[model samples]
Target: MLKLLFPILVMLGFAQLTPVSDFFTWDRNLILQGEVWRLITGNFTHTNLAHLIMNAAALMVFCFIFKDILNPKKLWGLLLSISLMTGGLLLLSPIQSYVGLSGVLHGLFIWAAIEDIKQQRSTGWLLLVGVVAKIAWEQYFGASASTISLINANVAIEAHLIGACCGAILQLLYYFYTLSTASDAPK
Candidate 1:
């Protein structure tokens, strides 16, 4: 939906500007110095045109695949929440700086796929398995050489892991919450 894509497109536009990109990268020292906006902004930043294009294309693919399953608000919420959680968790790792939407993408794909399953769409199972396997493989062997070369940075595998975990957990919590709310309604 344009509502969701608008913000992503705006972030992509901002990333194309050198000054904005520099100011928004997730830098630990800068964050320690109180530039906290980087925590959220960094997820929307990118290292190069290749990185931007790759993530943007992935976003479009996800939007097309899950469009019917996820309303724009729900999809945007998953993305923002996962981005924030992943960014915060990265601070606990050895990484001092990070950027790119891949982490949030992983989370969004996961959470949306689960929602698909809740709606009884069989494709959700395929997507869930595929993303879980991808994350698992990344954990075991590191990112693909082609991806590393394309992005020109050591992929933050930890971010991917954190994002996926957060996505699963959030979906679980939401499931429980909805169930409880429904149960509490008057008979």
Candidate 2:
């Protein structure tokens, strides 16, 4: 968990130092201008302290749930895969610019929740139901209103959907791989 928090804390500090969010947000125009680094860095940036705090809380929730299951390698793999997939989907869509870790948090939550289900833990079903409900609510109602007007950012439902899908897909692959490996082991 420290492995994940270290970078997020660093990025939060970097975001505080950056006066212009455009420097860290995923902007289609700037990306077209070859500022491709935004694809990765944008995941770490937030609109304001409130936004950062919300994201950090969400990350902690997911990390705490998956702490025993996620080693450094699995954590890194999930982070990179989910973020890359989220970026790819954003680039193809009409989103002009975006910031915050909400999207990645959705992915992390889904991955951990599914891992719980695979282990026959009841919390998995509860988490899955909550996630599905949240996504559905977003789809029907647009972005949920944030009380933190200081941050003043719109939630990108597309990012959440893409991230969740990627996580679900990754978990499915992991499940199959585990099954195959177990079956192949000599009795």
Candidate 3:
């Protein structure tokens, strides 16, 4: 597990070296100018220490939970899904400048929930409920000023939704593949 996550952690560490504003380097002007790489790169960039910490913490927790169940193969699939969905969301977003791992976190949460469901785990629905409620609160009420205060903040709620959808779709595909393969095997 560490082998897979180590490189991401290292890349995130290096990303911290660059100024926060650099993340917005591929903002409206650059996109208009045809620098498309930003759509993908921006997902790796973060604006501040707090942002990095929050994202890193979430990544650690989720990786710990899903890594064992997904194994190396599914881990790679999850990572690929996160990257592709994040980039797709960024490209579709009206907002030109943004940075955070909220999208990936959403993806992980959805993936985990779906996995639990496939395993016939009762906690899966609970987890799904919790995630949905939290997302709803964040989207409708905004981050509570009293509980979690954010400064100079702009939340890309759309990215979170899109990433979750991507994760759910991937999980569905994985579930179908597993079911078909199991059935096809000789008894």
Best by lDDT: 1
* TM-scores for every candidate against the unseen true structure: 0.92, 0.85, 0.79
Off by over 4 Å in 1: none
Report the Cα lDDT for candidate 1.
Answer: 0.87
Which tens-of-lDDT digit does each residue in 1-187 have in candidate 3? 7876777777666766766347533364576677666555566667667777778778888888766685656665676567566765666768767666677778888889988987898878888888878778777877656324442466677677777777787788877899999999999
Model 1 — TM-score against the truth?
0.92
Cα deviation at 26, candidate 3, in Å, is 6.4
Candidate 2 lDDT, tens digit per residue, 1-187? 7876677566666765576565778888888899987776677788778888888787777777788897767777787777777766789878988787777778888888888897999999999989878888887887756633656867788788777877788888887999999999999
TM-score of 2: 0.85
lDDT at 107, model 1: 87
lDDT of each candidate versus the true structure: 0.87, 0.78, 0.71
- How are the candidates ranked when ordered by lDDT, highest leading? 1, 2, 3
Backbone clashes, candidate 2: 0
Question: Could you list the CA RMSD of all candidates, in the order they appear?
Answer: 1.6, 2.6, 3.3
Off by over 4 Å in 2: 1-4, 19-21, 147-150, 176-187
* Candidate 1 lDDT, 1-187, residue by residue in tens: 7776777777787876899989989898898899988887888889898999999999988887877766767877877788888888889989999999988888888888888898898989999999999999999999999999999999989988888888888999988999999999999
Candidate closest to the true structure, highest TM-score: 1
